[model samples]
Target: MHIPDGYLSPQTAGGLWALMVPVWYAAGYKVKKTLSARQAPLVAIAAAFSFVIMMFNLPLPGGTTGHAVGGTIIAIIIGPWAAVIAISVSLTIQALFFGDGGILALGANCFNIGFVLPVTGYYTYRLLSRGAAEDSPRRWFAAGIGAYVGLNLAALITAVEFGLQGDLFKAADGSALYSPYGLSTAIPAMMIPHMAVVGVIEAVMTSLIFVFLLRNNPSLLHSYDGIRAAATGRLQLKPLLIGMALLLVCVPLGLLATGSAWGEWGAEEIQADVGYVPQGMDRYLGRWSGILPDYAFPAAEEADTGEEPAGAVSLEGVKESVPGYMVSGVVGLALVGGLAWFSTRLLTRRSRKKEQLD
Candidate 1:
């Protein structure tokens, strides 16, 4: 669930950022200590994988849309700390370039999906997958359940954040100044779909990936100390690369979803639904229109002169925008992948230098 800019009060956004800054630093410290030369690129691949998976939106109940964040699988394969790095990278790129999430709210988004999702799943899997053999079915089962739990928990937290905004921050007229949905409305609106549908999709995705890795390269699972490199050959990138390439090509399928997510409605939609825009939210709306807003290249000219927005999601819009969407997917993949790699390289290199000095 990507919270758009206007959905959150600046106080909420800033508080989340203050909490996240130390978490981010600690993630780097942990990843640098644990990430080996061979493991560095794995984080990059995981970041790109997470980014692309998030593009494939699924239709949720109440006419809203949602997607599977692959944070749990990344945590399983690497570690929760590295998952933070990988997921944060993916989310930052999406917010800055594609307008998937808000630039100001990136920290809050990362807190929900990047940190909470991975850490929840990682610990859940660890608790259940403990003492299971490298190739055990129990482990993957644990991973699936962990994913379901993690995704739902993250969604619940997101709902709470949006819910609190309505009550905590308000105009003099007693209208909400940010998100208009209070706890009762926001929680059910978010939780019902996630619990019924989105969480299941996330669990299935994680289980399948974990199964694939188990069959192909069990050693890639960092938490499994029993299956070290002594038994396995060099980590194979070709299979993972092929899978990501195919997903990139098919990203346009995400346009098939019909509605925006619950907390991601635009200003006009907010006005129509609630009778007015919040004062604070109005000021922050479209605070930063991303380069490739909503993952499409701007048309040379407006595609239409009609009631709906030119970039509105429809069958015709999907048909027209497929090429741009695919290109955007490719661009996102490269940016997240490269930036993730660079982050690992920088952190690991710094750790190495410190060791040399010692």
Candidate 2:
């Protein structure tokens, strides 16, 4: 649930930013407390997974399409803080390079999908899996349900934000506005079913990835395995079959997202809410808002469906969001990998010099 620009007032947008800073700090602090050595590689891998999965959009029966949020999966693998960082980085890449989302709304998007989804999803999973054994059917079931529900909750919050900012459902008399598909209808119409389908996708994907990492690399699951394994049994292959079924559903959905089907379905519902449905929306669709609970500027075009014009926000204009994505991948590798190698060699030479001294 991305909040398109124009949905939020400047005051509301700024207030959200003020609130988000503290939350981001808290998330990072928690990550520092929980991080471990083996977890580092897994963090990088999870970031990569988030990047790739979002690329494949699924079509819905409705004209609109949806894709996996990856928030729950990342949270399951690397605590919610790290998940936020990962998703934020991935989103920056998508927006800057691909022009999928608006530059003005990156922070909003980060807070919604990155912070809201994962933080909420993590605690929810814990609450649901409270008493299950490791690999127990109960734990798995709890995890899936928790993930599914968490996404919907986040989506609902996002819808409300839209309603507040854009007058999504206000009538002249201050009653619920009516539409062939107005904001009143769009809120539940778009959010409930869309989020439900997404929740299932998230749940199965989380379970599968959880199982995979558990069997092949238990260390990767270290953060929550203590709690999760205590509830379930151990990760196993049965979820693989479940994952496949979910994936099958996802494939057709992704095809539809990239195709015209998603547009026809989702557009009808969304269009009913707009004071004047901007043509730019046809391209921005899912990428319109930053994440949820905030406004991300919708992608803009001069004439509906073509390249953006000169005045539109561009990769160069949105430097805050891109630097980390463009440079961090290389710099992080160098500092984490190259520096380690160089430091080792320097230490070895010093030791050799000490031997000569001896």
Candidate 3:
């Protein structure tokens, strides 16, 4: 869940930011000690995968939408420490470029989707598949189950954050200062769709990719049973790259999703829903409008005509958006993946340096 700006009070957002700075540092140090030079670039691919997979939105029960985060899969392939950096790269790009999430809420978003999902999934897989052979079915499918668990857990944590905002913060008349949804509404609204639909897609996607790589290019993955790493074959990047290209082509499919995600409604939406926009949201929302707002090209203002009718979908808007969505996917992939590659490459290089005192 991409928590927009103003959804949480400044205190909550700042607290999460404080929590993540050290976690991000620790993740980098751990990855530096373990990630080899050859393995670093694959983190880029995994980061790009995380970026693109998030574009495919599936409808939820309450008219909201959800999508799979490839966090668990990335963790499985490159360890949770590296997965943190990889997925963080994707989330940062989405927030900064696409306005998918708020700038102030970036830390909270990363903590939930980037940190919690991967670490939980990675450890869960390790626990379930412990002592199992590399090729064993239990080990093979354990990642899928881990992904399911991890996705739901992340979703629940997001719900709690949204839920708490309403209860803890209020205006003079007791209207919500931030999000209007308390635990009673936020919990069910966010959890039902995630548990039923989104988790299945996450599990299946993770397992199928795991199965394929384990069979064909096991070396691409972080040592599962210490067997895949020692296997004879490695370096089959073509198929994976091809798959990425295919995903970019289909990224526009995300637009089919009809509604904003739960708790992610904008100021206008909040006004319509609750008859008043939360004062905090009115203040801090849209502090940073992204370069490509909503993954669409800025529409050319019509010839002095008044704004189009509310809720009206124009054919031209669709045509313009599809290409913009496709371009946004490419831009996101390049930016996210490039940052991952460079950062990890620098870390890996630093790890290899020997201090020689003259």
Q: Which one wins on TM-score?
A: 1
lDDT per residue (tens digit) for residues 111-168 in model 1: 9999999999989999998898878899999999999999999999999999999889
Say which prediction, candidate 1 or candidate 2, comes out ahead on TM-score.
Answer: 1
Candidate 3 ranges with C-alpha deviation above 4 Å: 225-234, 300-317, 351-358
By summed lDDT, the worst window of 10 consecutive residues in model 2 runs over 293-302
After superposition, the stretches of candidate 1 with alpha carbons farther than 4 Å from their true spots are 226-233, 305-314, 350-358
Q: If candidate 3 were superposed on the true structure by all CA atoms, what would the RMSD be? A: 3.3
Q: Worst ten-residue run, lDDT, model 3?
A: 225-234
What is the TM-score of candidate 3?
0.92
Best by lDDT: 1
Task: Give lDDT tens digits, candidate 2, residues 1-358.
Answer: 5444333444555666677778767765665555433234445545555654564465455435566776776676667777776666666555554444445455666677767877788778778777766666655566676677767776766555555543443435553222223357557755756566766788897787666655665544545443234223333434433543353333322222333212122444446545434343444344432222111122322222434452243443333323333333333333323332332233235433543566
* Whole-model lDDT, model 3: 0.84
Estimate the overall C-alpha local distance difference test score of candidate 2.
0.52
C-alpha lDDT score of every prediction, in listed order? 0.87, 0.52, 0.84
**Arranged by TM-score, best first:** 1, 3, 2
Cα lDDT tens digits, model 3, 60-86, are: 876778899988878988899999999
